[model samples]
Each structure stands twice: as structure tokens, then as C-alpha cells.
Target chain A: MAPMSDSSAATTLLPPGSLPLDELIACPQCDALFHARMPGRGQRTSCARCHTVLIAPRTNAYLRVIALALTIVILMVAAMFFPFLAVNVQGFTNKASILDTALAFLDGGFMATLAVLVAAFIVLIPLLRAALVIYVLAPLAAGRRPLPGARHMFRLSEDLRPWSMAEIFVIGCAVALVKVSDLARVEFGVAFWMFAALVVVIVFQDGIMCRWTIWKALDDTRNR
Target chain B: MQVDDLESTGRHAEPVTARGAGLVACTRCTRVWPMGETRCARCGSELHSRDWRSLQRVWAWMIVGIVCYIPANIFPMLKTQVLFTHTESTIIEGAIELAQHGSYGIAFVILFASVAIPVGKFVAIGFLAWSVRRPERLHPHHRHRLYEVVEFIGRWSMIDVFVVAILAALVQLNFAASITPGPAAITFALSVIFTMLAAQSFDPRMIWDHDGRGPDNHLTSETP
Candidate 1:
């Protein structure tokens, strides 16, 4: 709390072992560093310089995040096979699912990679992240020890966070569907709603879960 | 001032550091430690000052993104089948179609999300990467802000791909009317994925590596 302002652009010296250096935290955004002190449940700690939320612990966050991750898995699986859309126009009607849409690109060799990449980002990455989240969180939520390789699983999940594009896919579809409405008789399928629900649940999961809290929980439980 | 005198004065108005006093902050938990300390005692994370391969990864991913982006804009994004008559539209054509149909709102959104954002991201990421290598081009703070902007807007670039997914999913009326994702759908998604990866591969901490030679640093700050 020593005048933690962005104007002080230079990082101050940490006196050698005079104060425990391990107790400090650096603002990830502005590089202005601060002392590290975990916020209690229902409290939030933000970077003093950039205001990025450093930690915000919530009660029962683990349980809620786990629940949402499970929902994403179910919704994603259902969204794959279930008809995502059925447009009927002038006596011709066709239904398509997410898998069908992704596979449609697999016409030739070069396109095959495209199809796989699309499918991986929109479907596989999300599903994988959700599964990893569950694997990492469920044991901690149950007041049990961290699962085997929980650290690696957690790291992988964090790394893949940006790669999971399921929510983006659904929002993009909504905008696109609005544009296509005039051209065809478009109808939302079960998978569309499922994807929609999955998005909401995922947002909720992200909101509830605290990265610092979970990591602390995992680390504490590991050596016990 | 002596270290003890400064502490006793309690006006401790110096910059914080991971480099000062032989200290390093944990990237995950933000805990500061002695420079030689390999592990963050609190979070059990390997502590490092800056990722050594950040620029390398950023350049590699940007190359892939640039490569994929060529095909993304060149190919048709969506194919519309109306009454057995097929029509293919690249992203620009689709936006033009939307504008012609008087859905200007959707059209602008499409253009903004598809073209403007992606191009902006490429430029921003390139600028950031360049700034890291050549810090004299722009203010380090401004470069850091640009990096944040790139990271924040990364997901929104997928809007075009999403629209494609939605239309492909919802507009299925057999021969009368149906939309299939064109080859560009996959390419565009890949471009977005690569750019995102590029942004991620960049370590923002490098932005502050200005060595005090940064132009106009003194002009911005008013010493209190």
C-alpha cells in the first residue's frame, strides 16, 4: 500500500531478506508490484495500479464451477449430434448438426485440416477444458486431496482457456442467423439452445471460480 | 536514506520490483522472492522474471496466422443454396449483401467483427511484437495498452466464424435453402486461433523493458 501508483514507473528495490520477499505480488498489467495477501472469501483484491482483479474468493466456488463444467460437457455432447437447425422452405427441409457443419469442410485434403481445426477449437477444446476443470476441481470441492497430476491438469486448462471457442461460436451463429433470416426459413434446433445454455453456464463458472483460491487449495491439499 | 530510516519514515515512496534487491515475483501467485529462488513457496509454482521464449512463440504464431488469414479472406465464407441455385459469398460479399438488404446494423457488425477487428489485431500484435524488439517506435506504456487491447478483443474476432456456424446450423431447408460453411470458415477460425495464440505468446512484461531511454516518460509524470 506504499503509494501504489502507475506514475512510479520504476520497480523499487526489495531489501535483501530484510522483509520476506515471498510476501510481495506484482501487478500483472502495469508491473507495479505489491505485497501479497490473500483476500478472504466474499472479498476481492485488485491490482492497485491497473485495477485488474487479482483475487476474489467466493464461498462454494469450487462446487459451482464444477457444476457448470459438467453442464458444458453434457451440452457440448448433445450439441454435436442433435439437430442444430432445421430450415423448411418451399417444400424442401433440411436439418444440420454441429458435427455435420464441421464435417462439411472435409471435402479434400487441405480442407480436412481446416475441418479438424474448426472442430477442435469450437468443440474439442471446450470439451477438453471442461473435463480438465472437473478433474481438477471435484476432489478439492469434496474436501479431499488433490487428484493425481492435478497441477498439470489445472495448468493445461488455464493454457487452453483462450482456445475454447464454444461461446464465441454460439454468439456468432446468433448474429449470422439474423442476417440469414430473410433468405431462408431458419429455425433453431435443440443444439442451438444447448450451446446457448452452455455459454451462460460457462460464464457463471468463470465468475464464481477464483484462480488464486483454487491453486491455493490444490497446493495445500497436495502435501497433506 | 538508510533502509531502516526509510522504513521508519513510513513514507516508503519507491518503485516495486521483481529485479530489485535480487527479487523475482511468481508469475502465477504474484509472490515476490529472491532472484535465485526457483519455486514460489506459497503456490509451488516455478518462478521466473520473464518468459525467455515469449517473442519466439509470438513470431511463430503470427506467421501461421498471417498464412491462414490469406485464405480466410480470399475464400467464400458461406454458400447459400436457394431453390437448388447455389451462391457463394466471401465475407465482404456477405456484408455487402446484408447492406443491400437494408440490414445495415447486422452488416456493420459483420464488417466490424470480421474485417476491422482481425486487421486491427494483426496490426496491434505486430506492433507489440515489434515494440518488444524495437522499443523506440512507441511509448512502452502505450505498447502495453495495445497489448491489453489485443488480448481483450481477441475473442470477438471469431464473430465471423460464429455467424458462419450459426447460419450453417440454422439454415437447412434441403434444396430450397441451406447454408454450408465454405472453406474460409475453417481458415478464418484458424487465423483467429493463431492470432490469439500470438497474443498469448507475447509476454506483456517486456513492454516495460524501456531502460529509462523511453521518450516522453518524464513529460507524462508530475512528481507529487
Candidate 2:
């Protein structure tokens, strides 16, 4: 199962010294160069191209600590309340927030609840990651170097990023909404809207806006 | 020969460099090539150039898709009807119905995969794009880390599409209860597709653009 075809081999070229910071981690199996984190002094990370474990650079320690804290908070919130959405059809209406859904699954004695639990991975774990990033960056931003924990957290977040499933939840909702329309009467709820908003805000605040800048700021502070 | 010179000129005229020139060493034969070559002179492995424009375009589309997504979820993505009576259903509504019917597994899966994941992706991607646009050069590693996050999570955004497809295919009772696609379904699907495109279009190499010198020479020296 080759990822690329044989004849479509025309390649593009780049100039030397044009992208100094671009790191290449090779997949041991395929010998392909893919972008990856720098190996830590003693730690090993897997290659994105082949999933081969390799030694890479260390990440900041405080970031992990902060991420852990934030993760805990988000998890607590997700556990306490329903995430979003409720459905009504044929004189019967059922509702569950994110938390309610979890409990429902647990009580229902269905192992499939694991899928739902996994979905929260993005929502809850990223919160921890964000906290870890803050922890690492805040002191670094203030001109202090992070300890080893920051590096571990950085790696953990990187690994976890792909596994988070919040966006997928939204997709299922859209699909189900379409299907359920012919069968029942469905209505939107406040929690649904709030969860939607929360997803947006969380992405805005964490993914694009917050973590990188703080790290960059910390990097600059470290250089200074 | 004339065309080659012209192509080179055109390449040089462009603001970005081709990705091929960035590979310092061949993964297959360990042969190093100048950043300006299209193939590993030794093994003929195709090379890549650095082009952030695709990423930028993807970001723009993702923003638009996310905007559409919000409305798609909020404004009753679908209208449901049983026997000529109609009701509107938001994302959450559908999930609730599944839960109440003792299908807690399906219900939670719907909530997380369809509703939550898509929104999270939008936020995460949006944040990553904005951070890239910033002039700061610190934390190049972390920026790369963020790019990995966005890229890894990109596919999970499709969970919604999968759910929709699955339910639409499987859940057909006809009259006693039937499922139908809605206006928002198209929009939601587009949102997922666009965001996925955005993720694909985003060349993570752009994160290293700030360090525009070339890969670290120490990469080879440090490897065992």
C-alpha cells in the first residue's frame, strides 16, 4: 500500500536557508521525511510519517502543569452539566447535557459510552493542555526557563490533539438532525447553542490564539 | 533549457520557496541535495517547497465555513415532521431523543462526534491561522506543535458527516418514522469539507518560515 503513485513523481524544490526552523523526522519504515518535534535529551517520540519512536528535544515543564490544571477544570464542568442537545418526537422528549450523556451511558450499562467519553477528550484534555501551556509560558514569558514537565506536557498535548473528538460530535448532530426530521419533531435547546458557542470560543482561545503566542512569547523572553 | 530558466525566474519571483529545496538529507539514500533541487539527486525522491499561501487560503475558507456552521447548528439545522406536523431540530435535540429511547450509546456518540468535534476544529484551526499571521518569531517549536494539533484533529471533524451518512442510510422506517435531509445538512457537510480542506491546505512548514535560514545542521550530527 504505497501512499503515492510511481509516475506522478515530479517534485517541487525550495531554496536553501529559506525555512531554517523546519524540522524533519523520518519514518523509519518508509524513509519519508515528515515534520515532527525535536527530540528531547533522553525522551523518545514517534515519527508522524511512520509512527516510529525517536528521540527528540525536551519541552517546557510548566506547560504540562498548567495544562493539567485546566484539563481538570474543564472535565469537572463537562461532568457536572449536559454538553448540549435534546430531542423530542411523538410526544416524548429526551434531553441530556454533556454530563448527563455520560451518566446516562454509565447507568445504561453500555460500553459504547467509551466513544462518548473519547469525544470529550478534545474538550477536557485540551483545557489541561492549555493550562500546561500557560504554566510553561507564563514563567518563560517572565524570563524563566521551563522544567522537564513542560516538555512532557508539550508532547502529550501534541499526541492528544488528534484524538480529541468534539468537532465529530457536531457532525453527528448535523447528520442525525437530517435523518430525524422525517420521523419526529425536533427542537434546539439553550445548552446546544451554548455548547456550540463554547466550542467556538475554546478553539479561538486555545488552538489559534493562546498557546502558540504564549510559547512564542516565552521563547522570546528566554532569548532575552 | 529556456523553459527551465523561465520557470526558475517565475519561481524566484514568487514570494514563497518551493518545498523540495527544504530537504537537507535523503531519507532513502542519505544523500543531501541543495534546497533548490526537485529530487534527491541520488534516489530521485520527490522534494517539496514551502508555500504558506495554501494554508492562508484554507484559513479564510475555514473562517467562512465556521460562520456558516454556527448558523447551521443554531437555526434548526433540520425540520422534522411526523404525519404532516413539523418541528425544528437543533443538534442537541436529536441527541436527546436517542438518549431517552435508551440508546444512550448512540445519543452520546451523536452529541460528541456530530456537535462538539466540528466546532472545536473550527476554533482550533482559526487560532492556528491567526497565530501564524502574527510577526512574533518566538516558540517556533510550539507553533509547529500547534500546527500538528490542527492537522491531527482535522479528520475527526468528519465524525458528523459519518454519523449523518450512517443514520441516513440505516434509519429508514418510512411513515411510521422516516428520516430526511435538511437545508442545514448541506451547510454542515460543506462546513466539514471546507474545514478539512483548510487543514489539508495548511502546509505546516509555514510555522518555520520565521526561522528562514534552513534546517538545523545539528540534526544529522546529533543522530546516532
Candidate 3:
């Protein structure tokens, strides 16, 4: 990396004797730089070196992402209350939900933290991310200035991307259900299907999201 | 090889990094700013051409991850009580038992997500961190790809922990049968979290900083 000297300068925008900084784009994955170009609708710009999608702004993408985010939020809430799985052995039957599983360790002990973490990983983080996306994009989707702190909220959602593991949780449940099927009769509950759909929705939302578009929108409009 | 590939694309003969042009991109919003800028005006996030302390943070979190991983493997992941007998199984033992029961698919998923992925993450993150300093040991392009894979797969290791949680919650029968998370579940979760932090703390930009190979005039004198 070039030596980052001149630490005394506090100006936020200073392009000295070069192309304007706003016209430059760097691939997040491989750090390959490129002169920024707005892709046509239904088109995307990928890093030539590593093929990471750098810019992809589809028409009405923000609105679509908002719709999907709403679905994630609704499904996650329902998945928490409804039974996730039911086990029957010799007429004895019990059903459990995601909330139940998360609180299973909360009766008091070091495990209480684990319970909270489980709830956070599967339920809380995803919910928060969806909520943040909606908050950050709702105004932008409506052709208005972003709500105050939209930039920060968008960044927060991006940072939490890896921590949101609802999809992994669903796969884990599938594996656990199979493992337990041998011991007893196991049945998927309504919440299981909801979680499955939630996974699909989450994946679709993430795939369709174009971070550059959102950032550009946030930049173009000054938050009120 | 990377240069040749970039050239074949006919866009540029080689990659041009933001830092090479005396610019910094916001980690959150991907907005490029001049090198002197300390924060992104668009997103209000701190900007750095490269995080100088990234490798140190990577090693610190990696050590914690490794420490938690030791107990995660040694202790039982789940405990089950049936009738008057109790059985406990660690992660690998549970996978093996599943395999013996002919649930090879679930077993493989468990083994891959729980064992192979985590171990691979530790190794990959370690190598990435180590290779940053000794850049000549591995091709930077390959290292960059490895870094991406490690970041993407680190969270999936939570599969085993989720499996334990779901099984414990679903198998709660009054006296005939019951299952609960063992001591290892929390440790395993911690290991996954720490490893993820380790991966996140790593600055991938360091991989490209070894030489001045951008589209701009190359700097013959190394910064450091």
C-alpha cells in the first residue's frame, strides 16, 4: 500500500492532480481498481481479476429488497412462536419452537449466555438486519431523502451480514430432525416451513441487493 | 497470471488499487476518498487506505478461537437421557453414530460444517494472516480467494451448535426421554464466533500491498 502520509489533513474530499475520487471503484474482494462506470439497467460490473460483482443497480431493486425484508421480519416473528418441531415416542409427544430452543439454556447458569447468543444468531440478528434494511431503504425507494442515520443503519446491516445465520440454523434443524427420526417420530411444524421460506427470502434479498446503488442513493440525497 | 487475465479482459493491463491513486475507500459504503480523508462523508464511517493493525487483531482473535475449539471437541456436545440410562456424545462421535445409523447424508453435513469447515477456517485464516507478511510464499490472487472463502464459510460452523440447541429443545419428554446441550455447545459456538472475528479483523487489502503493480506509475521505493 502507498504510505498513508499527511495525517494532519482533515478534509474529507481531496482529489489532488488525478481523476476525481468518486469516479474510482475498488473491488472489495481482490482490491482491483477500476474507473467507475454506471452499469445499464439489468447489467452489472464485475471485477475482471476475481469476478466479484462491484456494481449492479437494478430498477426498483430497493423496493424489492424492502419487500423481501418485510417478509423476513414477519416470518421470523411467526417462526419464534409457532412450533418448530414435534417429537413423539410411545404416545408421549412434545413440540418445540425456536424461542423454546433458545430459552432452553436460560434456566440459570453459564449457559444463559449461550441461549442469548443462539437467539441472537438465528432470530435477533436477522430480524435486526431486515429492520435496518427497511429503515435505510424505505425513503430511498420512495424517491425521498433517506431517514436520518440511514447511512449508519445501512452500514450496521452490512456489518451484521455474517452474523445473521437463519439459513444455517434451518439446515442444522434439518440435520437434527434426521438424526432424531431414528429415536422417535419427528414431524416438522408450521414454523419449520416458515423458517424454510424465510431462508429462501433472505437469500433472494441478499442476492438482489446492490450495495453500490444503495450507497449512491444515500450519497446523492442529504439526510433530513 | 493475474495480469494476463486482466489484460485478456481488455479493460486494463493490470489492476489499479484505490490506494495506488492516493485514495481510500470507505469500508462500509465503498465510496472512494482522497488518502488524507479520515472518514467517509457519505456514510460517516472511518476510512483507511489499509488497517495497519489488522494482522495483530487477526492473530489475537485466532488464538481465542483456537482455545475455545479445544474444549469444543473434547467435551460432549449433547447429552441424552432415555428411561434410566444417559448417553453423551461429542461432535465427532455424534457424526459417527449418525453414519452408523445409515443417516450418512446428515452425518456428512454435520462433519463438513462442524469439523472440516472450522478446521479449514482456522488454517485458512492463519495462512492468510501469515502470508500477508510473507507475500512471496503464496500468490496474492490465490490468497485473496482463500480469504474470501474463509470469510464466507466461517459462520456455517455454527451448524453443530444449532443442531445441539434444536435437539435439546425438541426432545424434552417428561421422564421417558430428554436431551440437553452439553458443555461443548457453548464452547463450539464461541469458537465459531471468535474465528469469524479473526477473519473479519483481517484486512484483505494487505494482500495487494506487497508490490506497486497498479495501472498508475509504479513506486520503486517500498513504503516500509
TM-score of chain B of each: 0.82, 0.62, 0.88
Residue A37 in candidate 1 has what lDDT?
A: 64
Please give the DockQ score of every candidate, comma-separated.
Answer: 0.38, 0.07, 0.45
Better candidate by TM-score, 1 or 3? 3
- Which of 2 and 3 is ahead in TM-score? 3
lDDT of 3: 0.80
lDDT by residue for model 3 (B81-113), tens:
999999999999999999999988888999999
Where does model 3 exceed 4 Å of error?
Answer: A1-17, B1-13, B210-224
TM-score of chain A of each: 0.85, 0.53, 0.88
RMSD of candidate 2 to the truth, in angstroms, is 16.6
Docking class of 1: acceptable
List, residue by residue over B26-70, the lDDT tens digit for candidate 1: 666565666788887655667767665777888899899989989
Give the Å error, residue A16, model 3.
10
DockQ ranking from best candidate downward: 3, 1, 2
lDDT of each: 0.71, 0.48, 0.80
**Compared to the true structure, candidate 3 yields what TM-score?**
0.90
Candidate 3 C-alpha error for residue B130, in Å: 0.9
